[model samples]
Target: MKKLTLLFIAFIAILSFTACTEDDGFTFTAKPDPEGISFMNQTADTYTLTSANANNLAERFVWNEVDFDVQTPINYELQGAAEESFSSYSVLGDVTDNNLAVSIGSMLDLAEEAGLDNDPETEAPNTGNIYFRVRAYVGADAGNVVEQTSNILTVSVTLPEATEDAVELKRELYLVGDATAAGWNPDNNNTPIFRDAENDDIYYFEGRFAGGDGVEGFKLIESLGNWQPQWGINEGAATSSDILGGDPQAFPVSDDAFYSFTLNAADGTYTFESIDASSAPTYSAMGIIGTATTGDDSGWNQDIDFTQSTFNPHIWYINGIEIFEGEAKIRADNDWTDSWGDDTFLSGQGNNNNDPNIVVTPGTYNVWFNDLDGRYLFIPQVSE
Candidate 1:
C-alpha cells in the first residue's frame, strides 16, 4: 500500500510540472515601455499617438502594424513658420530568448528605424514651434498591447533680421610747396569736402593752378585733364604770369607757393607732395635778365630790358631773378613750327615727376607742391 501511494504522488507532481510548462509559451504581457514608437513636430503643430510597451513582453512584442488613425507614419508635414511634423513606428526583434524583459537598446533601434528615435525633451523645429507624442503595439493582436505617451515637448524658433554706418574717405594730392597757398581747406573748416555720388564715403579736392589765360590762372581741372597743379614756366597758353612776364602774379618766387587743404573728420590724414625735376622751370626769368635777343652790331639798336619796365610782369620769376630754380622731373621736350615762330619748345610733365600714378588709403590729406610747377597737380575723386 505504501509503494502504490508513493507512485501516485510522483504521477501528480509530473502533471503539475507539465501544466506549468504549457502555460509559458507565447504569453503576451504589455510592457511598461513601448518598443518602437516616436513622434516629432518640427512644424508649429501638435501631434499625438498611442504606443505599446514591451518591458516584459520579450520577443512576443513584435509590432505587426502601427496605426496612427489621425496621423500618417514616417511622414513630414509642413506647418506655419517653416516648421514640420514627423511620425515613425518600428518593430523590435523577438525578445523571447532574453526572458520577459525586452532590451531598451532594441526599443531604441526600433524607434530609430521608425524615425521616432529623436529625444522628446530636446526635439525642436527649425522655425516656429513643435509638439510630439508616440504609440506602439505588439504583433497584430490589438488585445495584447500597451500605450505609452510622452509629455508634449514644445520648441520655438525665430527668424533673424540687414546693417548701416558712417562714411569714410581717403584723399591724397601732389603739388609744389606747402598746401596753404593752394586754397585747400585742410580741415574742411572753410569749405565742405564734396562726397562722391556713387559712394558717399569718398571725398575729393579740386586742384587749381595759378597761371596765364584760363589755363594760366588757378583753374580747377580734372586729374585726367590736360592741366595739373604744378609750378613750371611753360611757353604756352597754360603759362603762369610769373613765367610769362617775369613778374610774379599768383605765386611769389621768394617763397615757394604751395597748395594746402584741411580735413573735417579726425579719423585719419594723408599727405601729398609734388616731385620736382630739372626739365621744367621752378621760377620765371624776365626777358632782360635772360635775353632771348641781343642789341644790333652797331650798339645803336633798341635794347629791350625787362628789368627796366615799371609795370610788374605776369611772368614767373625767382625772387626778382629771371631764371627759374625748379624744373619738371618728367618732361616731354618737342619742337614745333608756329605761325609766329619756329622751333618752339613744347613740354608735357607730371607733378610727381617720378610715378605717373599713386594710390592712397582712406583719410584726410594735406596736399603740397615742392619745387614743381603748380599747374601739373591733378587731384581726382576715386572710389573703391
Candidate 2:
C-alpha cells in the first residue's frame, strides 16, 4: 500500500509541474491601439525654405504612440511623397522616437524633388505640396505582418528667387608653402580653400601660419604639382593683393598666429586677418567614429583618427581611407563633447545639435573637416 501511495504522489507532482510550466508561458493577442497613430500637431500652411538658414531646423514632426498590445518592440518611420500619391514614398526617417527633426536644407531638397525651382526660366513651379505620414510596425517586415499607417498630412513649400549678383567660381585654388599644412611640398596633397556657398568666387580658410626663419610665406596654386596659375602678393603689401600669374611674391608672415584668409577671385583680391587666441579653445585631437569606419568592433566602439592640419588646427583630414557601408559622425578629443552628424552637403554645416548621422556608401574617400564653421567634405577617390 505504501509503495502504491508513493507512485500516486509522484505522478500527481509531475502533472502539477507540467501544468505550471504551460501556465507560465507568456502570450497575448495583438490589437491595434484604440486611438490610432496620427500627427498630433498641424503643419504650417506654407513653409519658406532659404539657403541662408539651411542648417536651421525646418520642422519637427510628432505623433501619438501606438500600443500594439504586445511586448515586442514597435518601430516607427516617417514617409514623404508627392501630393495625392501613396506609392513611391521616400523614407524621411526611420526612428524609434515619436518625433523627428528636419532641417531647412532637407525641405529645400524635397522641394526640388517636387519639381519646384528658383530658376524663373524653367517651367517647373517654384512652389508645391509634399505629403507626409507615419508608419508603425513590429519586427522585420516580411509582407505578412500587419502594419499601421497614420493619416497623410500635407505641407506646402516655396523657394525664393536666386540673387542676380551670384557669381560662379571657375578656378580651384590650393595652398602651398611653409606657412600652410602642406608645407613647402606642393605635392603633399595640399588642402583646397573652401568656396563660399552664395559666392563661389570667394574662398576662405582659418588656420595657423607658422612663420619660419626662411621662406616664411605662402602662395595659392591653381592645381597640384602644376603651379603656373599661382597667386601671391606683389603689387600691394602683404595685407592684400591683386595679382595672379607667373609666380608672384609669396605673402609674408613674420610670426606664427591664427589667420583668417579670404580670397575673392572675382576681384583678384585677398586678405590675411590675424585672430587673437588668448582665450580661444584648443583641441589636441579630432576623429571620426561610427558604423562606417573600421573600429575595434566597427560600431561606436572606436574612432578612426584624423590628421589635424599642422598649419590649421581647426582643419582635420583622412586621405584615401576606405569607408564601409554605414553612417558616422565627427567628434573632438576622442570624446562626445563636440560632434557633427548633419548630412546636408559635401561641404556643409556640422551642427552639434541632435542631428542625423552622416550616411555613406562603401568606397575609398578623402575626408576633410573644418571645426571653425562645422563644415565637412567627403570626396570619393578615383580607383587606381
Candidate 3:
C-alpha cells in the first residue's frame, strides 16, 4: 500500500511538469509591417490609391475607390511573381480566409486595374466641400485581423467676381467777399467756402456774414437801385431800430458790401450783388439757398430766409415760400424760440418774420431775400 501511494504521487508530479512545458512551447505576437503600407498617386493631376502595408507580410488587402464625377474600376496585383515563387493560382486565390503567406504585388495590381482611366483630360466634379478616406486591412493570423485608415484629405478648386471700377465727379465754388465789407470774409481763396470733393454730385455752401447792429445795418440786397445787372449790389445800409419797425433813423449809406457766387464744372463762377435803400430798412441776416427741383429742402422754398436776432440772444429764424428742392427747411418757430426766444424776432412784434433755410441742386438757382426796406435783393453762392 505504501509503494502504490508513492507511485501515485510520482504520476501527479510528472503531469504537473508536462503541463508547464506545454505552456512554454511558443509565444506568438503580431506586429504590422511598417514598409508595406503607403498612399499612392497623391497629386492634383493624378488619381491615387492608398495601401496599408508595403512591407512583405502574410495578409489580405481590400480596396475601395470613389470618384466625385465618374465611376472608377480598380484591380490588385502581386509585385514579384517568379522570384517570390508565388503561383498565379495562389496569388489570385481568395486570401480572405488565410492570413499567412499572401502576395502584395497581386493586391496592388488588382487595385490599379479597378481605377478608372477614361477621359483623362476631363476634370473631376467639384465635391462641393467634401472629403475622402482610405483604409487598409490585413489578416494578422487565423481569426485575427488588423486595419489602418489613412489621414483624411481634402481638395479645393473655385473663384470670386472682380470688383467694379467707378468714376468720381466733383464740383466746387470759390467765393470772394466784397472788399469794402467788414464781414463776409473767408480768409482762404484756394479753399472755396463750399466743396463737393467727395463727388457726391451735390452742392454746398457755408460761411459767415456780418449783418444786424444799430449803426448801419447790413442788407443782402439782390438788385441795386436801378435793377441793372452791373448796378446790383449785395450790401447796403439800415438801422437796427428801423429793422424792428421802430421810427426811421437817418444813417450814412454804409458800403458794407456782401458777395455771392455760382459754380458749375463747364462754366466758371458767376457773381451778383445788391444794396438796401428803403424807408423801412432792416438788419442783415444769414441764410442758405438752393435749387427748387432737387426736393432736398423738406418741401421748403429754394430761397428760404433765416435770421439771428440780438434782442432775445441765441435765436434764429426760417420763414418763406417753399422754394429750392425741399432738401432743407428752417427750424419751426418753437425750435427757434427754444433756441433763441420769441423776442429774437427782428421786429419786436414778430410781424413779417419769414426765415427759412435754402437748398439747391447741381445747377444755377435764383436766390433772394425779401427787401423790407427796399425792392432790391441779393444773390449768394452755395457749393457742396
Best by TM-score: 2
Clashes of each: 73, 0, 72
Candidate achieving higher lDDT, 2 or 3: 2
Cα miss at 64, model 1 (Å)? 29
**Residues 1-384 of candidate 2: C-alpha lDDT, one tens digit per residue:** 999999999999999999999999956656778789988654556777777667655566778789998888778899887755766777888988786767677787777778888887888888888778999877665854657999988889877666553211124567888887788777788887775544545678777787757756888876578665566776763212212213568888777787788886544578888877556556788888888886334569788889987666788889888877678888888888888877643445677857678866666777787887677766656443
Question: Between 2 and 3, whose TM-score is larger?
Answer: 2
Clashing pairs in 2: none
Which ten contiguous residues of candidate 3 have the minimum total lDDT?
A: 338-347
Score each candidate by Cα lDDT: 0.27, 0.73, 0.29
Tens-digit lDDT track of model 3 for 163-254: 23111112222222333222223332112223222221122222223333433432221122211111112233221221222222222223
Off by over 4 Å in 3: 1-170, 174-255, 258-265, 269-328, 332-384
Error of 3 at 210 (Å): 10
TM-scores of all predicted structures: 0.17, 0.47, 0.18
Write down the TM-score for model 3.
0.18
